[model samples]
Target: MRVLVTGVTGFLGYHIAKDLLKDGHEVINFSRRHTSEVDELGIETIKGDLTNYEDIKNALRDIDAVFHAAGKVGMWGKSKDFHRINVDGTKNLVNAMKEQGAKYLIYTSTPSVVFGKDEIKNGDESLPYPKKYLNEYAKSKSIAERFVLESNGHGILTTSIRPHLIYGERDKNIIPRLIQRAKSGRLKIIGDGQNLVDINYVENASHAHVMALKELSTEAKNQGKAYFIGQEKPVNLWDFINKILEAKGEKPISSKVSLKIVYFIGLIFELVYKLLGKYDDQPPMTRFVALQMGTSHYFKHDNARVDFGYSPKITIEESLEKIKN
Candidate 1:
């Protein structure tokens, strides 16, 4: 099959493209910037922006399926900017897929869409989207994901995979940001650091994407459903970080800050960034960050396993070893 993967230069998209190629599928990568790294892997590359309907439509020509992995992800940003990239961009993609008569669309969503001030323990897809989102990123994703799922029966087979805290080799988000803060002596554990969170390895997360696409069908069970993908076991935030630091021969982080203090500091940062007109990018800390750091948000993957036969292949220990090396 011929597949077009948006955001192929991104962390998860890169792995998904590689996996597709290994499975003997013709892979075409769409991105704003052309990179020789993915090109060297023998993927056909197209430079395009997701927001532009023409660019997206051109890339869909002759494509069998689409993996919509591109998104605007951040804790802080103007609501309009997030809407343009996440919601409006997704609308454009869906419209293009309809015009090109694409068979399947597998959207990569986040579990944050269901998150709020309360803990989300053993939550499933049956749980409704939050009444209010903490940040623009989550709100936009919620809106976009709704469109993707609703477009399932409209001549397009669509499913969404919500992977939480994806981390592994080639990760440029959480791990690197934490290391940078640690080096700057700004790393502080929040809320006693006992919150359990789900972290998905890149390879396993990529495998979930492929499995969802392979399982796509006109059946109601396979159509218009979203699944939460993650490791089999949840890890305590502090324990996981300390283990990684110890394996890397770095000192384990011991200092801590109360959730109240962290929340206060995040409020200050939000106001300061707004006052400074720094809305183009994310602020150092935001309300969403505080909630995520201090709250336990894990999901039940029973639906994914039952609907798509999806199970994580890599163990947490194995993932940690790969990261350590």
Candidate 2:
């Protein structure tokens, strides 16, 4: 199979490209910037932006399937920025698929799209999209995911996989940020630290993408559905962070600030940042970060299991061992 993977330079996209190449598929990597890192893996590279229709169409040419893994991901940004990259980019990809008669589309979505302030304990695909998203990232993802799922059944097999807090070797987001804050002595446990969250290892999350692409069938009832892909078990937030700190030979520090205080502070930051025209980087903390850190949002993968045999291969213990090594 000739597979085209967008965001091939990203953490999860890199793993997906490597795995697909190992599976004996010809992989074409699409990204705004060309990197020798992917070329080192012996995969073809296409330098282009997802929002450009011609770029997407050129990448889609002669491609059998697509792994739509590109998007703007952050806690703070202009809504237009998020919409342009996430929503409009996906629209471009889907339209290109329609024009080129691409066979399959496996969209990489985030579990945060269904999250707000509520405790979404063991929720499934049936859960409604949150009425109000805390940040533009989630809002744009929700809109784009709907487009992917609804774009199915037009001779294009489409499905979305929602992976929560993906982390592993080569991770540039969560661990590095945590280590930076810890080194600066600015790291703190938000809220009571009892909130349970689901995290996915990079390998397991990438495997889910391939599985979804292979298992998407016209007769399968889950064609237009989204699956929650993560480690099967949930871990308490504080305990998880402590494990990471311990692995690094460091002690975990706790914060005593109330959630209300942080949330209010985030609101003030948002207002001031908007008024001051300063939206380039993330705020010290945003309302989205506060809710994500303080609230519990683990998901049920029964649908994934039943539909695509999507059981996660890497356990938390195994992931920790990998990280430790």
Alpha-carbon shift of residue 136 in model 2 (angstroms) = 0.3
- Off by more than 4 A, model 2: 217-221
TM-score of each: 0.97, 0.97
Candidate 1 wrong stretches, greater than 4 Å: 217-220
Clash number for model 2?
0
lDDT, model 2, position 228 = 93
Candidate 2, residues 1-325: lDDT per residue as tens digits? 8899998889999999988988888999999887878878887789999888999998888888899888899999999999999999999999999898788999999998898778889898888998898889999999999999999888687899999999889988898888788889888877888899998989999999988877873356568889997897988977898788767667777765677888898899999999999989678988888888877889998888888888889889888888873
Q: How well is each residue in 1-325 modelled by candidate 1, as lDDT tens digits?
A: 8999999889999999999999999999998987877877788789899899999999999988999998888888899999999999999999999999888999999999888778888888998998998788999999999999999879888999999989888889888887777778887788888899888999999999998888894344668989998899888988887776665566678888898888888899999998999998677788789989887888899999988888999998988888984
Return the lDDT, model 1, position 177: 80
Q: Give every collision pair in model 1.
A: none
TM-score of 1: 0.97
